[model samples]
Target: MRIVEEPFGKGVVVKPIGRLDSTTAPAAEQTIRDALTRSGHRLLLDMAELDYVSSAGLRVVLAAAKQSTAANGRFIVCELRPQVRQVFELSGFTRIITIVDKRADAEL
Candidate 1:
């Protein structure tokens, strides 16, 4: 997976490309954690290019959300692919994380 970061205000927009499974979750998680540590509050994850996400990927996302809240920041995810969306919905992750159809809607 490749992590691309773009800054917005004092926050950052993180885009992950490729599959985020057991093999890639660690790297992706680390990348996101690093971004969050420096990003301050508004961390928007744009998953437009992510083709697949496994349970490990979900754990990473959950951790990031919890960490953001713990630090009094905002965490948002946008543009989930159909399969990934189904996984999230079935797992009830939608209730815990802020998900929007557009990246612009991911308000800090």
Candidate 2:
């Protein structure tokens, strides 16, 4: 997977393209972690172009959330596809993580 990062106000929008599986999760995690550090710990995950995610990907997301929380910063995820949303819902991540249907709804 390729991770694209762009500035969004005081935060950064990270878009992980392609599949986020075990083979790609490590790199994705590093990029996201770096983004959190660079963007003052504020991150918005724009998953509009993400094709798929695996258990490893979920772990990365959880780690990012934890990191942001520990820093007392913000972390939001947006634009989840139906299948991806189903995965998150079934995994109980929807309750713990901040998610929005649109990127505009994801506050920095």
Q: CA RMSD for every model? A: 0.9, 0.7
TM-score per model over all chains? 0.96, 0.97
Error of 2 at 98 (Å): 0.3
Error of 2 at 4 (Å): 0.8
Clashing pairs in 1: none
Residue-level lDDT tens digits of model 1 in 1-108: 898999965699999999999999999999999999998857999999999998999999999999999999999999999988998998899999999998877777
lDDT of each: 0.91, 0.93
Model 1 misplaced regions, further than 4 Å: none
- Candidate 2: list runs displaced more than 4 Å: none
lDDT of 2 by residue, 52-85 (tens): 9889999999999999999999999999988789
